[model samples]
Target chain A: MSSNMMTEVLNLQANQLNAGASASLEAVLNAPPEARAELSALMKLAARMKRWLIPVRPSSAYRARLRDGLQLAAGHQETHRALVETRPRVPQWGWLIGAAALGSAAGIIAMILRRRQTRKDASVAESAR
Target chain B: MEAEEQLIERAKRDATAFGELYERYVDRIYNYIYYRVGNHADAEDLAARVFYRALGNIARYKQRGAPFAAWLYRIAHNLVANFHRDAARRREVPLDDIVAVAEKRAGPSQIAEQNEDARVVLEAMRALPAERQQIVILKFSEGLSNAEIGKLIGRSEGAIKSLYHRTLIALRAELVKRGAE
Candidate 1:
């Protein structure tokens, strides 16, 4: 059989399986007689594959433990969130830091000017004397 | 959905509400992780982390009409990927573990045969590309539709169908190469 025909058959079988319909070995009606056995094998294999990965539940102990853990973590998170919501909002640290730097620079400049004035005043006093 | 959304809204600010959400999705997320990792211990740990991360980021969660479970699946997916990366090796599913989960009433010989087949199938499954492995797990283990799997993996439904078909083919080839009937 041509590859396209084979692909068509496989895809038809896939569509059936995906739709939650069982793809029995005899389900490949469109395939040529020569390819029917191979197509049927593939379909049967796909169905068996689905059954192999059966859904297994987590143990009750693990489930309860994880739930408790989430609760505790969520409690901490809620407390932190509440604190954030109720706490007074502060200005951005960048703005506050910029203001502090400007203030420090101004203070330093003022001190330097005052010292220069005092030195000038003392020199003037000496010159006057 | 309104109830779930209201629960999610409350969960953002209330711990107990989040607990309700936890109860609803714990099994599903666990089952997804269990199949991906093929073990319970790692599945439990990863499942716990998924909820923790989800809880931490609940405040940022927006209801965009995608199911809330999708977001949790994303978390589980990322963690499982990291687990594989960190382990730095592919771990085979223990045949005994698979057998233990089999039907209890089966005779010892039948159970042994079933376990061997399961082991072969799981080995082939693990050998597939990561995306294919994920497709198989979500489809078979979680019973998600192609559209649902597409949404979870950010693919269109058509893309999911193609990928799933290819995955099955690859799995069959792998099984045949392994001498599995």
Candidate 2:
């Protein structure tokens, strides 16, 4: 059998052969003794491959540890999320507004002190004259 | 499956729900990693990382028409790949694990022979290219269909089938060489 035919036969066995493939694998497999032998060998190999890699369950202790770890992660994420939500949020423009308010207050206080000092200095000058 | 979807949605917000998802997929993921890595300790570590990563990123996970399990498997595939690359080494099946498997399958008289066969097969499997090894493990260990495997590996079903065929052929050749030895 051609390599393509063999591939077709194997693909059919795997159940993923393309819908539009021309040759029937069944016909090819049934045609000759040599083909039959090849099919048998391939099938046997497939079965062996399947059988050898048995499904192994993780240990119970490991399962419990994973469960604990996931629970911890979930808790961590929840806490982190809650902290983000409840933590006092300074609005994006809050700092700018606060800085402007402080600057204006400081300016007013400085102007008042300067005016008082100027008035006192003028009175002193007039008395000296 | 609808229930699972709801569970996944709940899991996105609920720790208990995420734990349930953990319970459901832990073994399958662990098994898949075990076969890929050929050991228990690394498998467990990688499997844990897969879940933690999943939980951390669950909020961003969308259905995307694939099952949640597929998402987990993809995480697992990536972790295993990194594990391999970082370790810069490939581990064959440990002899004790092979013996344990062989003991479970056959009588005492056949234990030695079965162990040998198991070792040979595992070595051959490890010798396969990374993607092909994954295909073999997903196909045989997880018992996933070609379409399902394709979904996991991002390949067309036809491509998966062809890969499987070639994998089997290479495996057979390896086994024949072992027998000759």
Candidate 3:
């Protein structure tokens, strides 16, 4: 009849479906005769759909082959991952070189200042004489 | 026996553990792909790929309260989608394939009737949207409950019910249309 009525009917059917099998059957049995037939038909349709596509087992040969392939691949992946995790961490070369250069410059500057002071002291001593 | 979660955890680092997980799910995944693609060769290829990809990414898998099977189904769903996109072609389920399935049970006359019905329904299924097709396959082929289906597809149970109801209606309409033709 009306769209809202149709929506309500569909909602009722959906609720029944979500309730699982025994409850659904109980719902169907208790439904008014007028609605029962349609609901029953829908349920039959679902069952028929299941029957229509019978689950076919994959060939044993293919299954075995795939299993072997996956095992090999997994072994390789595990090895790679282990290598990555266990590998030693390398020191950052840039920072090490920079620190060494800074130390050498500081040492040279100190030596130059000491030499200047010594020369100044010698000049002072000569003047006193 | 260790719980599935522990097995999956071990599987993340252990190849033998991963192999155990594969044994548990390979058939269901194969059947799912078979229904989707309607052929043995492609189903086999895709099913293998699903496991291979899962093995490659197992370390990234987290236990988010859903079953591990849900994760595998999600992978299968995506790969099937990609397959359709790449092929850019409609499915053509050969009669022989339907016959082979039907032959698994029933007499000759019953097999004949089943083959026709299977073909008709499969053809009608193709006309439905992709989501609807997946719902049907998960519900019918794998016998998953609506809640399980919802978990795999990342939908609420209520949403799955609504979709399932709508899907049946759509299938009926399609079947009627085909009958009229």
Candidate 4:
């Protein structure tokens, strides 16, 4: 990037950064898709490393006052958790019945084994007697 | 009315509406401040204050142009504006912290280049004015748009554009100077 162009880009980016939380993203979206992607990627990167520029506090009582706004911006810049939840589509009852049947079969086999062992023990005792 | 409108209208009259508004904007506001403030605890406290102030005086809100977010930004802006004066703050991201963050994300070596570049850019951002600093963080870091920005700070779209441009120019100059330094 030419010095002048780089300056403009930097200025534009700074302005965007300073534009507060309310600036129209549509304008940013209007940027060439490549530029948009590049800008976003750059922003994301800077955001992650921002902690170095700003002050960090232990997550505790003094939470409101920012010691360094810019650095804090960087540190807190992570992938934002989605505000809305997407419900996953659940499957039908086939798996549920199959699981239940499998569990029931295991229980029945366990019972049968216990009974056979008890009968074997009783028969051995009677023979000894 | 928009969702913001619904939210604000309900909040304007009722306490639960106020809570709902808090719920809606808390993370966004918290994110905005957390990135700029550089600490989780401070961001949370400031965010609570932002909602507290908003809730306390919600009756004064006049909704003609812009959504509820503008008012919120205004509150956030005003809050952060005073924050700088109260404390002497350093504006450099420590290298150790970057390594720590990278280690948590992936192998440190793979993300070294990305980490350094981001650190440079963040330092440049820290060099900007509070107004500009807050705006840039909110837009880029927190990912809010211009219309939302305007509503938060109570500016017209055109005004927001002009201010945004000016702030960018100022920031770019700072970044260049920092690079040279």
Candidate 5:
């Protein structure tokens, strides 16, 4: 390849690492067979460097809000979490558990009072007889 | 086959499904951030912040006209921009920093090449206003479409592709002239 062509080829090679990578590669692959053959080794080298250097992966989570005021769900919140922190998210569950324990204890206390009343009633009847 | 559709579907109601998305993109985002910030500690922290911001704003995500990854990079670009803006540093990466990535991605010589690539790219990146680097990293390393990239960075598609192509030419010349050193 001429030096200018080499520069063009190398620049094209760089784009193979761009976000437009597939498009660029498709453009090349669709070219004449001679061109493809000529670029094959360079393509492989570019691919190798890309895979090694600028490997593409989505490591950041993207969130776009379409409408306002909708509550976003929380995820992977350890960003600023204290080592010993455990956040309570569901208020309903806490309320339910507390209410249930309270109800159970009230039931037991009511049962004890009823038993005492029955014994008092039996004693009053025996005294009357 | 359909990464975007799968991410959108899982992210719909399941909050933990967002974590799955986090798992999918964490390393790539980390590396991208690492490439920019040039440190693992900062990369990890920024990576977490990016996801945190995503979770905080998940309800606002619109999958139409934009791929999921682009939106995330948009957030990352903003955070890194703010980071550079508020810091003592000019966000210039030392050549040695690429060495850290070297051990994992390539051998010593390959590391040298990547380091050289990093030097060239980082200089060009730092030479650019923050806005340009935002486009460069997302377009080149993250492999986003110009339209997708434009949406994230708030530029027209025409402007993006042109800028992208121009940046590549500059990057190549810069690398060849100074990178192999």
Candidate 6:
């Protein structure tokens, strides 16, 4: 048989083909003596593979430990979130400091302007006399 | 499926729900890892890590059309790969474990024959490529259908079918050689 034909037969025996296609292929496999032997061997191998299916489970202690670990992790996450939410916010000192500096500069400017106005008034009074 | 999704969503928020998920998938994940690592201790450690990692990232897990178990399998697969790489050695399935497994299912009259077959099969399986080994394990051990296996392995159903057929053929050849010996 061609490799494709062999692949098809093996695929059929793998039970991967659709129901209708599998039925026809099963007939084809059964019709030929060589194919029948091949199919038998495949079935035997399939049966042997089932020995691996003996469900091996982790120990009970292991399961308990895993559960505890997950709980601890979840608790830690919740605590961290709460801490973030409840922590006091630091005052923004930079903005306060900036406003103070601007106020000081405005006061200094006003004082300088007042002195200049007084000097100009004394000069005007002397000219009028 | 919808119920599982609701459990998963709850798991993201509730520890008890997550614990429920753990109970559901721990054995399947452990079995997958055990066969890959071929030892109980590493499998346990890796399985623990798999769940820890899953829980840590549970909030970020999106369904994406695959089951939550698929995500867990993917995590297990990566950790097992890393374990193999870090260990820099392929651990063969211990002969005793194979004998134990076979004896559990086979009668005393058939123990010797079944044991030998189990050993040969495991040895042959170890010789297969990692992906092929996974395919065989998922198909046989977990009893997952092709579509499920494909989702876990990131393969289409057709691709999995071809790989499985090839795997069986290789196993048959290996068994024949072992019998001849």
Models 1 onward score TM values of 0.81, 0.76, 0.74, 0.52, 0.51, 0.72
Q: How would you encode candidate 1's per-residue C-alpha lDDT over A1-129 as one tens digit per residue?
A: 665555556656655665778764554676678877777777777777776778788888888888888888888887887898899988799998999999999999999999999999999999999
> Which residue pairs clash in candidate 6?
none
Model 1 docking category: acceptable
Q: How high is the lDDT of residue A43 in model 4?
A: 41
For all the candidates, what are their Cα RMSDs to the real structure? 4.2, 7.1, 6.1, 23.7, 16.1, 7.1
Question: Where does candidate 3 stray beyond 4 Å?
Answer: A1-41, A91-129, B88-91, B103-110
lDDT of 2 by residue, B92-116 (tens): 5667777766756577779888877
Local accuracy of candidate 3 as per-residue lDDT tens digits, B40-96: 878999999999999989999999988898889889989988887886555677777
Tell me the spans in candidate 5 whose CA falls farther than 4 Å from its real position: A1-12, A15-53, A56-129, B1-13, B89-96, B101-117, B143-159, B169-181
**TM-score, cand. 1 vs. native:** 0.81
lDDT for each residue of candidate 6 in A1-129, tens digit (9 for 90 to 100): 444566556655545322212234454555467676775576567556665445577889988887788789877866776798899998789998999999999999999999999999999999999
Which portion of correct inter-chain contacts appears in model 6?
0.51
Residue A104: error of model 2 in Å? 15
Question: CA lDDT of B24 in candidate 3?
Answer: 95
Candidate 5 lDDT tens digits, B110-132: 77876665555565455555666
Candidate 4 or 6, higher lDDT?
A: 6
Q: Given candidate 2, what's the lDDT at residue A49? A: 61
Every model: iRMSD:
2.5, 3.0, 3.5, 11.2, 7.8, 3.1
What C-alpha lDDT, on a 0 to 100 scale, does residue B108 get in candidate 6?
75
With a 3 Å backbone cut-off (N, CA, C), the pairs that clash in candidate 2 are none
Q: Give lDDT tens digits, candidate 4, residues B1-181.
A: 2477777877665555565565566656776675565545456667767876776567678888666766777787678767755667534445555554343465656679656665666666666776667666655555555566666666655566556556655665666677621
Rank list by DockQ? 1, 3, 2, 6, 5, 4
Better of 2 and 4 by lDDT: 2
Score chain B of candidate 5 by TM-score. 0.68
Per-residue lDDT for A21-88 in model 4, tens only? Answer: 32334534655655665444444333332333333323322332332432233223211222223446
Which of the two, 1 or 4, has more TM-score?
A: 1
lDDT of 6 at A57: 79
Model 3 clash pairs? Answer: none
